[model samples]
Every structure is written in structure tokens, then in C-alpha cells.
Target: MRRLGPSDYRDMPWKNGGGVTRELLKLPHPSEPARFLARLSIASVAASGPFSVFPGIERTLLVLEGAGMALTLGGAPEVVLDRRSPPFVFPGEAETSCRLLEGPVRDFNLMVDRALVEASLEVVHLAPGGTRTVPGTGSVLLHGVEGRASLSGTPLAGEETLWLEAPGPLVLRSDEGARVIVIHLTRRESSSSGT
Candidate 1:
């Protein structure tokens, strides 16, 4: 398992050059650094505008701070999102744009190449002195969001993340309550055919 803190994050301009993002992790294609299998980042949206397009990527986004925003994907109806809302999934290639509800907002994002891997994102709440077992069969990323948490007895502070390459069931415990975002990624069977 690998632990990543704020210092490990890389700051980069958005693909569209409209804003900035702190890339927490990026798994590049084995032979092509320009092509990535999966990526995790946090974006700081300072103004309302169009989102960068990613032709073959699936995107999942969750508000981490501020009042949140509303997203208009392609020609679909606008979808409102806030801190309490569940993570929203959408096509990265869609014609997407957003409007801030109150002001600038910070959000967590997960993007996966649909043809290479399948992915899921969810938030787990732990009460004080609570413990939960998280499956770690594939690539599981546990990001601490609120309070303090421990993964298999290893302490994880808020905003920190632990990447479990592959393991059995893992215990996650919180002594004073906590909230965590878990991302599960698995390679597609067809992707193993050397495609």
C-alpha cells in the first residue's frame, strides 16, 4: 500500500486551461505516459465555464467544499450538486459546463478510461470508535475526508489517501468519527487481451 499526502499531489493547469487541478494519482498506460488508465484529482473551480473533454473517459465528481454547483451535460437537464449529494457520474466526452450556486467550489474527481477499467466511487461514514471492513481485491483508494481514520492500523489524516494495490479485507477505523471517499478500480477482462 502507498500513502499520499498533500505534498505528493501535483498541481497542473486544466486541459482546457480554464482553471487548475491537484492531481492526487495518475496511472499511465504501460507504454504511453500520454494515455492514462485512471486518474484522481481535486479541481478548484473559480468561475463558471466549460469542462475539458476526454473522449474515452468516464468521470465521477463530488463536491468537497463551498456551496456546490449545477452541471449541464450535453443537452440534458441541469443537475445540481452539493456537499451532501452523492458522487455524480457522467461521460467525460459530453459537452459539460457548470454554474456555481454560491461561489467558487472545490471538488474531487475520478476519471477512468472506460475501455481499460471499471470504477466506482462512494463515501463512507464512520461513527466515533467505529470500524468497517473494505474489500481490497483490486486497486482500492481510500481518501480521508473528515476527522481521522486508520487503515489496517495505519493512521490517515484528513485529505490524505492510501492506495492499496491488492490485498484481502482491510479494516478502517475511526476513533473520533470520520468520513472517507473510497474508489475501487478493476481492469476489464477484455483489456487483459493485450488490447
Candidate 2:
């Protein structure tokens, strides 16, 4: 397991050069640094505009702060997302744009090379003195979103993340109420044949 804090994150300009994003973790393709197999980041949207396009990648996004925003994917009708909304998944190749519902917003994003793996994301809420067990098969990421928590026995502060590379069970506990984002990534059987 690896622990990553704010200092470990790197800020970079968006692919479209419209904004900036703090990249929390990224697994780049073996031969291509610009191409990633999996990536997680937080974007600060300061103005309403278009989203960078990433062909062959699948993306999941959720509002992490501020009021919310509306997304228009391709020709589909706008979809509204707020802090309470569940993570939304869409094709990275889609022509996407956003209009802030109210001022600026910060959003968490997860993107993966769909041909190589499948990904799932969810949020878990823990009340004071609560504990939860999460399946730890494949690649799992636990990110502390609110309050303090612990993975197994290691303390995790807000905005910190734990990356589990092996298969097992993970125990999360919090003495105070907290919220955590969980992400699971599974490699495709066909892609693993030669690795």
C-alpha cells in the first residue's frame, strides 16, 4: 500500500489548457508517459467551458466542492451534478462542456483506458466511531474526503489517499464522522495474457 498526501500531488494545465488539475495518482502506459492506463485527479473549474477530450479513455466525475455544474455530453441533454449526486460516468471522447450552476467548483475525476481495464467508484459515509470493511481485490484506492479516518490501522487525513496494490480485505475506521471515496480497478483478462 502507498499513501499520498497533498504534497505528493502535481498540478498541471488541462489538456485543453482551459484550467488546472491536481493529479493525485497516475499509472502511465509502459511505453508512453502521455498515455495513462489509470489516473485520478481533482480539477478546479473557475469558469464555464469545454472539457479536454481523451479518446479511448472512460471518465468518471463527481462534484467535490462548491454548488455544482451542468454537463452536456455530445448531443445529449444537460446533466446536473452536485455534491450529493453520485459519480457520473461518460465517454472521454464525447464532446463535453460544463456550465457552473453557481460560481466556481472543484471536482474529482477518474479516468481509465477502457480497453485495458474496468473501473468503479463509490462513496462511503462513516458516522462517529464507525467501521467498515471493503473488499481489496485488484487495485483499490481509498481517498479521505471529509474528517479523519484510518485504513487498517494507518491514519489518513482529509484529502489524503491510500493505494492498495494487492488483494485482501481493508478495514476503515473513523472516530469522527467522515466520507471516503473508493475506487476499484480491474485489469481485463485479454490485456493480462501477456503481462
Candidate 3:
């Protein structure tokens, strides 16, 4: 397990130039935004605008702060998203954009190369003894977007993220008033290996 600080994350522009993204981590350190095996970042939706699309890259977004925003994906109906919203996009979608419903807001982003990988992310409210064991292959990232938590017995504060290499399982839990958003990233199993 490794801890990553928000102050250490890298920032870059979107391919379409709509907005900027603060890249947290990628398969290869310092990998370009347009090309990465798996990428994590945070975007500040300071203005109302359209979301830039990246074909073949599956995306999952969550509102980090502020009220929320309305999202339109391809021809699908617009959906209102806030700090409590979950991952909503899959691969092969046409267009995705957002318009601020109540001023500016912050959002978390996760994109992966679908052909070579798959991922799962969620925000769980943990009480005492509330623990989650995330399983993965290759690697996985656990970001504490909210309260304080621990991974494999190590403490993590808000905005701190952890990268776990290939292993059996990962543990997450909080003590006292800590609750965290757990993100689990993993490579997809090959069909040839047999389920």
C-alpha cells in the first residue's frame, strides 16, 4: 500500500480543451491523458459546458464538492448529479457534457482502457467494524475523498489516495468519525483463463 497526496497530483488539459484535469495516477507514471491504461483525476467544473469525449476509454465520475450538475450522455436523458451521485457511464458512448445546476462544483474522474481492463468504485459509509476488502489484479487505487480511513492498517486522511499492487486483497476501515470513498481498480480477467 502507498499513499498519494492531493498536492502531488499532476494537472493537464482535456483533449477537447473544455477544461483541465488534475491527474492523480496512471499505469505508467506521468502518462499522457489521451493514452493511459487506467487514470484517476479531479476536475473543477467552474463553468457550464460540454464534456470532452475519449473514444474507447470508459469513464466514471462523482461529484466531490458543491451542489451538483446536470449531465447529458449521448442521446440519453439528462441526469442531475451531486456529491452523492455514483458512477454512470460505460464504454462506447457518443457525447458527455455537464451544465452546472447550482454554480460551480468539483468532480472526481476515473477512466480506463476497456479493452485491457475493468474497474469498480463506490462511496461507503463505514461505522465501527465496517470494513471492505477490495480484490484486484495488477493494481488498485483507494482514494479517501472524505473522512479519515485506513488501508491494510495504515491511516489515510481526506484527499489522500493509496495505490496497491497485485495481491490477494486490500482492507479499508475507519475509526471514530471517519468515512471514506473507496475506489477499486483492476485488470479484467481474460476469457481464455476460464471463470
lDDT by residue for model 2 over 34-55, one digit each (tens)? Answer: 8999999999998899999999
> Model-by-model lDDT, in order?
0.92, 0.92, 0.74
In candidate 1, what are the lDDT values of residues 65-133, reduced to their tens digit?
A: 999999999889999999999999999999999999999999999999998899999898999999999
* Error at 116, model 1, angstroms: 0.8
The list of candidate 2 runs beyond 4 A from truth reads 15-17
RMSD, each candidate, Å? 1.2, 1.4, 3.6
TM-score of each: 0.96, 0.96, 0.84
Higher lDDT: candidate 1 or 3?
1
Per-candidate count of clashing residue pairs (backbone under 3 Å): 0, 0, 1
lDDT of 3 by residue, 40-155 (tens): 88987777887876677888888888899998877889899887677766553567778898887888888877766667777767776677776655666777776778877788
